[model samples]
Target: MRKREIVLRWHTIGLVRTGSTNYLIHLEAGNAFLEAANLSLSQKSKHDAATHYVNASLVFKKDDPKKSIQCLTKAIEIYTGKHISATSTLWIGPFLSITYTTLYTTKFSRVIFLVLHLEMGRFTIAAKHHMTIAEICEKDLVDIEQAIRHYEQAADYYKGEESSSSAMKCQLAVAQLASQLGQCDKAANLFEEAGKASMENNLLKYGAKGHLFKAAICHFCVDLINGQKALKTYEECYPMFADSRECALMKKLSEALEQENVEAFTTAVQEYDNITRLEPWITSLLLKLKKTISEEEDIT
Candidate 1:
């Protein structure tokens, strides 16, 4: 008779609307009824809870998160009622944390919470979502170092998983960010790293341009030093040119190395004219490269 009464109560509770005050009363009564009757819900109940959680995630995606969180909490309660394992609990915990963190805001606490959420997204293979959150941290939070860290992490995750194009783009983004932060060496290293990864993955056709980029950076560095070493570095990079811009610039650089004065400059102009007939844009850059080379040569 008691078991029959408990079964009736459970059915009534399940049929009630979860959003109503009466539903809360039923839930409390159902818990007591289940305990008294020694009746654990079946696996079907747990599966239903999982389904509800997924549905709630979609519904709450852009809507009222507080309501979504309520639904998720109820779903979790259902799962718990069926005695779901701790591992499953771990899986659900991050989602709950994400929701709570979104609801609450504090000056110092927000930073910590966002980092936690970022780490959670990273661990879950949510690269696109993780990148978005990282950008928020970098821009809104003003945590440049943390932003770079997440960007690098996202790149590595993509690269390690064979997402070559995405990984390369992520790496490029990090390089650009580093450059903006006035960390030229770090940017150079990231570019070199991306280049190596591209080559090792047989993506050289896509990555070959990076070698020339590195050479340009080295050339700039050389100009800063006003030493023969800079010119030598440029020479080393000259052979890697597959682009018209690089090829033209290489010719201009070679001419500059040979000619040191106004007379040599006149000779270079003639040589440049001969080269420009083959490629006109190259001629335009040659003149600029000549000026740059001349200035550096004077300083040296």
Candidate 2:
């Protein structure tokens, strides 16, 4: 081994052993690892460098999270081939967990490593992997937009695998985020797709009612014409929904919005809520639909 590589390794080991007590030492050790990574003769050395960077990050985590994330990003870029910014609210925990756990265990780690580096032809595994990462972004980090992108990727892979149920599962998650983001048209289309898919499955047919109901509401947010058209289509596809309370509420709200009658819209929602409690997400979207009528009335 070269004199520089040997020196860098010794420096890294010494600094890391003493770095825990001194933040500056920790930072210096990180810098040394980065330098070693650049001069390293093998992938193993580079991997060790990345691991050391992660250790340095933990030391900076409490006092300066941004610096910690920058270190983590540097470590990630070594493996992921791109630098992730600290400004983005994405939790890097998933990436770090995969790195640490896989490297330490060396079990299924090789499979994932092959998948990442080689881009192996394992669509189902890749799809499921991305889905897990997407869930972490959504549920833990609350980064809905990032989660949507991952879910879309997972859905595409699932489709390629001819896994209808799994694809719809991902699509449904994206639809929920779209509704929250006020992308009414996208949400409506995705929900409609989910409803159709669910109706085709005996075990999931009951969920079709909920999906169709959300679809109509999303279409309503777009406009009354689209809402009415969607309602008719949903009713034709699933006759059970036509007789349901949710469908009746949608019809009542449609009439109320068409006439710009705020009282009628409020009454319809109140009556529905009294019978079956609406989830907060549903209630929020309903308010947005109501806003359209209120705005139109103001204009007229």
Candidate 3:
């Protein structure tokens, strides 16, 4: 009867959804689960309690972020086995398991926790969490702006930790998004920094040319003179960049942009596309670049 009651409580907790008026009920159930876990010292019960904490946090997120954070912190502590008594985790037997209301309950709770941490100026511990949120935004939610925001924040934190490789990865993600949004100057600077950093790492040096090429393209969107200057600087920094097909393509596109020649740019892009596939993102940026040149010609 006691075990059946426990399972019913777990089921009741799982049924509560976000923004539902059952906030207090879920919180009480979560506390009861924790108490049961402590009394019985069951690992699975602890896990159930942690999951309940996460769901409860989500329920109160908008109304009371502090309380939400408190609940999420408890959930994380339980998940990581911190502060809980070691003996309380003894796996006696699987009694009951409650499926999460949302598949992303844990991930969402962590993201919310770190975002609040960021708002409160606690950046030191947010690097990994921010990166995780960034990936979730990019891959799961398909929110490019949020992904860029989180990636940029992660880059800053990574730089503080002296994790240059990780920071460069974030920079690359932001740069790609910036270029897609036609924020050419921001993209150009980030790509240039990432390229320079890549050139310094023996393992990443081969990929440096691709970064430089993208940077040069972003600069082209800003101005032909800037593009020419950037391409020259890239070649000087990495001699191998000058010998690459990307370098040849950039030179052709730069010449076209300088003369406001749309046909030449289109032909160059087509020739390159025929030899090597240009991904949709690259194709989109190229179209934007071509439009800029066309707009300039129309003005002339």
For each candidate in turn, give its C-alpha RMSD to the true structure in angstroms. Answer: 16.1, 9.8, 11.6
Q: Per-residue lDDT for 1-300 in model 3, tens only?
A: 686466556546544434346656545544544444343334346555555565655554545544554665565455334332323322212452222333224466665454334333333345555665566667656777877997898888778767788889889999998887778999999998888888888999999988898898889878878989999998787888999999999999988887789999999999999999987888888898899888888888
Cα-based lDDT for every prediction: 0.48, 0.73, 0.70
Give the clashing residue pairs of candidate 2, or none: none
lDDT of 2 by residue, 1-300 (tens): 875557468556645644466666655665565455444425344445555565555555534555555655566555444333433221133233334344445567665565454323345655765676577667756788988997998899889878888999899999989889889899999999888878888899888889999999999988889999999898887987888888999989989988889999999999999989998999999988788888888898
Per-model TM values vs. the true structure: 0.40, 0.61, 0.61
- Alpha-carbon shift of residue 273 in model 1 (angstroms): 19
Can you write out model 1's per-residue Cα lDDT over 1-300, one digit (the tens) per residue?
Answer: 554455445545543423345534544443433332233223223333344343433233233334433444444344333332322222223123223343334366765565555434432253443454456556656666766776777677676566777776777777666655656556656665655555455546455544445434434333434323433443454334334454454445455454544456457557745654423433443354466757767799
Clashing pairs in 1: none
**CA deviation > 4 Å runs, candidate 3:** 1-125, 139-142
